[model samples]
Target: MGCCVSTSSRSTCSTRSHGGAVSPSCFEVGFCGQKRTKRTFSDHVIALQHLPSVPNRIFTNGKSRTSCIFTQQGRKGINQDAMIVWEDFMSEDVTFCGVFDGHGPHGHLVARKVRDALPLKLLSSMHSYQSRQNGSGRTCFRGNSKKSDGGDSEKDGSAEDRLNSIWKEAFMKSYKAMDKELRSHPNLDCFCSGSTAVTIVKQGSNLFMGYIGDSRAIMGSKDSNDSMVAIQLTVDLKPDLPREAERIKRCKGRVFALQDEPEVPRVWLPFDDAPGLAMARAFGDFCLKEYGVISIPEFSHRILTERDQFIVLASDGVWDVLSNEEVVEIVSSAPTRSSAAGILVDSAAREWKLKYPTSKMDDCAVVCLFLDGKMDSESDYEEQGFSSATLQSNHSGNAVESDDGQKSEPSLQRNFTVRSSEESDSYGRLPPEFEGNADTVAAEDQNWLGLEGVTRVNSLVQLPRFSEERPNP
Candidate 1:
């Protein structure tokens, strides 16, 4: 059963909620139409729900079964936490792509915030892109699954450079905007809430990447024989990497496990907890702010290819289980983009489910894109022989179905909007968050200063963000 827990300080939208701390008049809770609480102002800190937090468990051979809490009510959980195969995302302009992974709770809500935020950010960024393009007369361009490197044929003009400038604006602006939107929502406090984001912006022949988290981006191309090859263009925010591990220890953050692991091998969450979240680097997680969360910027504009066969975008749900090569194989063999996403999620989710029956099934979110084989060829859309052109998808259900054909437990998920020709939304709403949680604060704030070797790219320009036109704020 799914339950939603929210403490609305004000009553406006009517959605079910529970286990929240709200004032007698402004707050209310209802389960299946039964009013559990009524007329109360919400407390500053409250659990959207009182769901159990068991150890992250996954059954062997099960796919990505990350634990998730769904309010199962109305829009209350619409964005609360969920995952979908995103079977179809047909587009005419630069393929729209994104990856949003939430933490500290089910990813559905964070994902929703991201889904809403990205389009807004992109729309907001259009003004910036347009201004830059108008001023310089540069060519325009643009995911996770979107290739980082297009063929040399695609990498022609100032498109890559302009793309970088625009996206930088989008991410920084959206981060702040998201904070504001969440705060103003009916029931939500400044709880360390947020999600990791990685997206792509493509135009004409150019491709750009925008990211702020550990989620990765890759490019793949197939040979005439129909075999796919992939290349990774993103690096992880590993806290225990040789260089990073030492920095955490120096800053007084726990670099190793608390279970008496060896010093050199020991590691803890960049903020708190153990088991899974050890990333010294990631986005969102208001709790990690004190540790210089805002200081960490995204890595952008690695590369894109026309020879690029396909692109893959996924939450850690996919990475948590499949190897890079394994992921490539699944996507390469899949009949369609939607099938690719479903196959990947279904496989990953089951692994987690079987391994962690006592734990929450990791919700899997995948957005995959395949090249228009006919685009490279002089064939018309009709000649491309797209069996499902008018249809939004060409997915194969069994790609993710069980042996018995029974569907897995319903996880949280939501629809997303794609922004094109530059989305020009406004900016600056969220205050850079503070207040690290007890379990993770010490590590997150660990100030391992004066690290050698690794150079911090504070103001580096990459695709999707940054441009010479706008003055740095």
Candidate 2:
């Protein structure tokens, strides 16, 4: 059974009917029955009771076996987390889900803009690539299956190559476009503001993930022993990565950890010590663009089997306090599909308070997509040691270490607005003067500082093209 939840008791004035089932639009329903369009935390839950008509010109594409839930908690000021789930994102075979975590002064706006625009832009890029292929007298198939005139092995390799190339180009261009928009936006200043993006596009059993910055994507699958395991699908592109640090140094940028937090390495300008960005890749933060920071995303793809259960994408706030194993366990063991994201974020928020009492809790956002509605099978879940009672009993979960080195496990009380103005360090901002100096230095060394080398290296290595020849005009 597919289920969707509405967290608020209020009903909506306008409801949409899909496949004989009436679905409520949270936007039309105001909190407590009033009329408003602004989405508050109450309207956050969206559950499709039944899978809509599949392979049709309707929303949710052909993803009849998919269900998703998201939850967010604000900190430091405004909620810096923004996300979207587009059921019929592009075609009848695609579903797009993304989560963005904003940092710096204008991060909230940047995150929101990216959340609203990135998917459409990405879809457009993919469509353009396909159109170009069509013009070249080549056909491209959607999802995992493809039509080819080659042998089985050749077909498999060719299909993978085509899909990878399309996605790589799409991701690279979409990020560059998004960054360009951010820079040109009249109301927003992105010099020191930026957001991390972790996105997934599901077409049938095939999954394509594009990620930048520290946010991550994790897959929960059953092991041979029938135990749940978490598989990290995307790398955390932070300054600590050897290649990332090397690239920064090669581009004349500095990479080092703060005196207080020696374990967390950050990217800095060659001329100044301000705006210590933690992630080597991100959207906006133009202040560090010339200093080796980039918006290029890392892309990966996976074909799901029966063993795959679900995928979780979240910002660093969740990953900082929770391990991959713990996150998967909590998500797989959630009592309800809609509550999965909430429960995880709730647990993270509680951990943040207990772990870093003096520090302001970082904003937390999460997207959980259960595959094949498999979580609905109670007997199989129970046999796998994922009983509801076990989940409730182990509510305490695991103990986590705080930033200040304290360790604790607290009750999973949900708090969506856990902000404090007194928090000492809030994504330490770089003075305008520092940004000015960095820009000047980067401009002077643009030719010899290896910026072109870093850019070329950051680009994904191209895969063999399926259509090698273009039709003569």
Candidate 3:
């Protein structure tokens, strides 16, 4: 009465041993010793005699498969990061999710780099410098705890200072590595490649966040009706600010380098005036390395007590389509992280569908991390399929009233979950030495930013004429 689901013990692997376990498909297998039956779900299940302990493809719902490739070779003609990984053993608390939407060809590489290294960088930097005795040549965080005026030091420290120590070191190291990789192996797809980083670190009940570039981190929960508290952390590192514009005029607007284009994301006029950023600030664009691409990340701490709502981390794609508060309401209403991720991606895609109308599809990737929740049953993913994305014509998106005639807009439409795709198990297609490392890792020599940064594809995408070929904002 059980199908033997082979377990490779890898996060992406989904084998089936029918001991009250379920696969999306069903198949029958027969053996020589005794008549045996194995139920397969989707295309993942197969029946044969003397089968090896491992199967190339594991059981998957078949809605979608994890390509893990950021190159055009892996792009599935749509912009969606809809992954249903770790079918059963996903961690209930402290879920880490991120979205890397690249403005140019290098987007894919940027996305993969952050997913693999960003967290490790943050935690590692925090502990490394804080350690009193470390042989690594990095600076020890020994700032004066003295008071400004000869008075007794009342302020031992602010949370920002402690957090900034880590933020500064981690960002410095990560950006330097990212920039080095980008410069060495330039992705022709985008002459200027940069991405927004939004990280959600929920340690215990304490919620901490840090971001660079315009990728936003918005908060959502039911404390204040359907509205979400959009506390923006990172500022656009663009040189086009009014103050920057004025500074440029004063300096007679000195000659700009290939990287000094103020039109870049975080690049300000008069070059060294403000935090030097071409596309403002980012994790991996090495072109702006000379300008100290190291971005001072906005840091904050919030105890995720009863009043907090679901958290969202998305690329500029979602933000470009929806407002910050609008996103909060949408995800807050979402029952699960998977659905929330799906809804964000799909909704963004729909918006592109309307704007481009006649053009081909655009890429959109979204990931929503539901804070501290439990998924005890399958219905958690909705009964039939899942939540979906649709065209929203009438969006008075600017902070409206709720149906009780209350002024808050309910972010999610009730009873909405569109079932899209599921990951396909690798039972046969994998090489003998096949490990799931490549999906989440790059080759040792490929570490463009200390992790084998891959400048795989560099196709010049089409855009409106007279506009910047590579879109950074």
What is the per-residue lDDT of model 3 for residues 332-421, given as tens digits with 9 covering 90 to 100? 665544356556666666754564344333344454544435331334444425322111111111111112332322110000001111
Clashes of each: 93, 3, 57
Local distance difference test, candidate 2 = 0.58
The predictions' CA RMSDs to the true structure, in order, are: 19.5, 17.4, 19.7
- Candidate 1, residue 154: lDDT: 51
lDDT of 2 by residue, 1-473 (tens): 11222223333322221112122222111222345565542244333222121121112101112454444544445566676555544433356778888777667667877875676567557656654664687544434533345577687677667776777788889888888888888887787777889998776556778888877778888889999877767766767566677778888888886665444567776666656776788898787788788888877667677787888888777876676777888988877664677678889888766666655566677877776643344453354345565332222211121123322121111111111223212212222222444422221211111011111111111111325453452
* Per-model TM against the reference: 0.51, 0.65, 0.49
Q: Write the per-residue lDDT of candidate 1 for residues 81-185, one digit (tens) a residue.
A: 222221111112233456666544434455555553444344444444444554685432321123335674355335445445655666567556655555465
Q: What is each predicted model's overall lDDT from 0 to 1?
A: 0.39, 0.58, 0.36
Candidate 2 — which pairs collide? 4-47, 60-87, 60-88
RMSD in Å for model 3:
19.7
Q: Roughly what TM-score does model 2 have, to 2 decimal places?
A: 0.65
Position 372, candidate 2: lDDT: 60
Candidate 1 vs 3: which has more lDDT: 1
